[model samples]
Target chain A: MRAGEIAGRPVVTLDTAEDIAEVKDVVFSHDHGYLVGFTLNKRGWLSGPMKETLDWSGVRALGPDAVMVASGDALAARDAESGATGDAEDVVGGRVITDSGRELGVVTDLVVEVDEQARVVGYEIGGATVEEGPGGDRRYIPLPETFAVSSSALIVPASVTGFIRDDLSGFGSAVDEFRAQLEQTS
Target chain B: MTRFAEAEHTPVYSKASADEIGRVIRYVVTASEHTVAALQVGGRKSKALLADWAHVVGFGPDAVVIDDEEHLRHPDSDYEQRVTAGELDLRGRRVLTDTGYEIGALVDVEFDESTGELTALETDRTSVNGDGLVAIGPYAVIVRQDAVRPEEEPPAS
Candidate 1:
């Protein structure tokens, strides 16, 4: 499932049949590329700060509207560094610059493989020219050869710039190319 | 695959007679497995049917080709749950880091056109860290917080 759909949906408990909280975030394993659990934000102003994270095992089912859990007990606090979620990083809006300091665009989205293993594989870059209008272009870049990130900026080598594609179908082609290159190197 | 954003409203045609059956609606995937189980078609508000993946023949650029109308069936409980929870669309969601920094909103999603499998997410925010993806969920698209740098803009003089 795309992460956008369930982000703010209500969380319900099965036993008591109560609407407990709204899903604030979806946590997953970066390495395994699978959903791990969900973090809960309190319902109202009076609820106070509650640390409730429901692991994947705790989920009974994901329906069209609300997420069903076995019990309120399923909502418990989890260590940020634990398997409850992979290393959480915010990349969208981070600046992209080549090793030689040529600025690209801001990261607007990511293309994740959502089969059995849901891992992030690529990114969409919206450069200044693309963001100037409604019909502006978006460039798709495959996961690069070497890149680095800081809280503010995303850095990649110049060689990776050549792999950018402007459309979703092109992204598929780029993935194929990258996979083939990997096989050749190995 | 096309972005569900782009795939939405895409017409579905029957291979038997090449008749326009319905337009694309949304994809239904299980929460645990994250695998697309079916495609909800005929439109979002109308009495739509779940097009089981088994009968899906192709995800063409212009239209989705299906075996026949017989493959379209009423959605079951599993499919209903994901829809009620709004797990189908990941576009326009927000992004946050582990350090509690709010990044930006998601704008696009990439998918395998052939299998209708989701491949990636695009956000309004910029990134150069290659594929520094960490996790995604209802709250935010979390990446490696340590690799994040402060926003590049400087204070006005």
Candidate 2:
């Protein structure tokens, strides 16, 4: 599932069955390919953003309908470890550059591996760098296990260019192969 | 429970002299304790008069009863000075959750008439339980995220 799809999902506490909050944005740790947590908003129309952040470890399940947690206590103060991380929206529109200094394309969306763990696996690229092919204006590039990411660009290994898929249908296998290659090289 | 609105402007009487001293003005609240610390009694000609909550004999509907006129005193502390100037009045102050969301502005405060303990914080849209109150600052009243009840969910299909 795309990280964008998770935004606006209600966060429910399994113990009380109370809908405590709504997901405002999915914060991601780009360098580690791990989901940090979700920034929340109060659960009502026109309710503004909340101060508490929900860490991924607090989540019991990320169901299609709602994100489930053990209890309302799961929402906590944002500590130094999870604080200041970028959300998925921050990565969108940022440049995706190869480690070898090749500019690939601008990031359009983030593909998350929802079943295994809610981790970012690939980037959906669009704009001038995308090839004219079956995927139309977008292309999916698998993320290496570790990479460098700044506010303006994501730096991936140059070998990632070879594993870029046309769409999400075959993106999982591409992610696996890309990681395998990185492991072999290191 | 009595609302601050209902208590304001009510006449204050002295039990010892059996004479009316002043009218209730604004309440001096201690946000940390979520209780009324004192009462600002005005409508008198001399300097500002304040009656600590401890001095209040009863919060009757007709009037606030105090032990005597001596119980009323001049504003002594910086906190009391702010209260007398209407700086710390909770009404019209915005209510913010500890998680950083501004829910609404405080409309009225409800408290126990006998003990002066806060019972609820009311906004135009909702009422937050007093137990969830975290702090009341000059800028806004901060509360726990769960203080305001969430909107009822649409029935599941």
Candidate 3:
């Protein structure tokens, strides 16, 4: 699923179609460099109005100013292949397993990049600094096309789970070394 | 050359309270000042603080921010460890709540680039957006920099 960078653009759907709020930010994997779920901000008229954010699962289409979803009906409007979303205030915590079965540290938040045009790049994962350290590690887990929202779990394809467990050492000094170089050059 | 520029004489601004100069001169610098020929420095804030800064008009980039010293150190939380890893700074940090307790790190911060204040943080966990999504602000929540912990198995450093 994707949340294109459009400030107030609204996502639309067919019949029981739900409006996939504008893609506030997109999550991407720093390790593999792939598009993940998007962070959306529900449109509102008043200030301090509640904003909504959903996983990339609901999205079925992506357009310039709008995105179409598979189905975003009522309360159960929740379904994430990423697994478990208690709410924006509370997210399902635990390390994520990649499709390759690698360990991707508990997903912490979403990361986004916007250009001058306000165009958004694909979303990236915001990994927590768990019992991990030193930039921890980054892995891009596969995302299912859709998932059923459980009371606590977002419910994603096992294909993703299979890979969320690789050895964290694979990133060794490689990540750090690269980061050092980027800082030096920039 | 810039004030305190490559010169033989010692700099006075550095010796004086740069913070005070900043606090007193914000009106001219932040509000608008084309050229500052020999303006004095303030010692109100810090020389570390820049004269010109950008503001975020709307949603920009996501960044991790640590506010309230209370949250910095909790009863049974290792938040300090996470802060170091995320390299968090108040200038651009993401704020998050963990099961009612605000926790987590900020891996990335978003800015309007144009306006540039700090729109949000690229959070680590996907929290409930209250409505039906996950995000820190308009920005996603990022892992606390300190939370980037050491490996289960230490390498031969």
Candidate 4:
């Protein structure tokens, strides 16, 4: 499920089925790729901080237009009111760097799997110069590699660079090699 | 197999009559299996059309051929409508193993672009190397943990 789908949907209590608030941003574990919970804002309008977060366990049902929760008790304060910002960092524009310091490109998007929870699986990267023009060479980098995400960049190791393929289909060999390398080094 | 991004705008046709129907504006992928469930069709002067993968009979380099235009219809069920409405798109959704291990976010999907048939989901090394997609839902993607290769261990001190 795209993260955008859950945004702005009604957050209802299970027992009361009351529309308590609206879903704001889904807070997920970047490392584990699962839903941690959801941040909520008052229904309508995009102003104000999201003070409440509902854990995934509290979610009873995810419907077409509404998110059903067990109770208002499921709601928890974020960072205990210290103004914890949501993960809205448009990492799409972040730079990509290799462990050997070769600059690859910028992060265009993240590929995730949504089953029991949301998890990040890979990244879409492309050169800054070729992004908008035809024939831009975009590539996908799978997870479990030596990579780091800071304020404005995503860094990977040099070994992972060999796995970079132009398209998903052609990347099969690269994926197998990367997996093999991980097993050997482990 | 074709990427979701490239699958957009691929020409579509009717197999029975071999008449051009429309271009694929977008796709409706299933949440659990990570497969193309339906295609949203659009073209100049044509009414909106949604065709399920079940109706597709063949795929070509230039076109996706469905049984017939009579097979196209607006999604009727809430689940199907949600898929058609982009509410259940798994393209960028995150995934996890049944054991709660972090897999990664879904980056792309590989499928028969012309046939609208889903083939596989590419999430990350864990999900990619796993047996296959076991479940796909709004919450998370689940794969066989046993199928997952062990992560690179930190060097022994």
Off by over 4 Å in 1: A1-5, A13-18, A28-35, A44-49, A57-70, A80-89, A99-101, A127-139, A144-149, A157-176, A182-186, B1-157
Chain B TM-score for the candidates in order: 0.66, 0.90, 0.25, 0.71
Winner on lDDT between 2 and 3 is 2
lDDT of 2 by residue, A1-186 (tens): 787778887776644345688998888785676888899999878678999999998887775556767678999987777544678878899999998999999998888886545688888898887779976988899988776567699888999989988878978999999999999999
Please give, for residues A1-186, the per-residue lDDT of candidate 1 as tens digits. 335456666666544334578776666554444567767777767554357677767776554356666668888788666742432236567777777988878777655544333455566778683444433577766664333434477675555567767666656668668756755755
Lowest-sum lDDT 10-residue window in model 4 chain A: A81-90
Q: A1-186, model 3: which lDDT tens digit per residue?
A: 123223344545422223435555544432233344445566555323224454454454444434445445411332345433322213224445433555445544322222221121111233553344344454433333222222233333334333332233432233334334435654
lDDT of 3 at B121: 36
- Candidate 4 per-residue lDDT over residues A1-186, each given as its tens digit: 345556777776544334677877766554544556777887656555567778777776565456766568888876544332234234567887777897878776665444555555556677753344332577777655333455487776677776765555645456557868877877
Tell me, by lDDT, which candidate is best: 2
Model 3 ranges off by over 4 Å: A1-4, A16-20, A47-52, A74-186, B1-157
- Candidate 3 residue-wise lDDT, B4-88, digit = tens: 1211122213212221122212111110111211212233433322222211111112211112111211112232222222332
| C-alpha local distance difference test of each model | 0.60, 0.80, 0.31, 0.62
True contacts kept of each: 0.00, 0.00, 0.00, 0.00
**RMSD after CA superposition, every candidate:** 19.2, 10.4, 20.8, 17.4
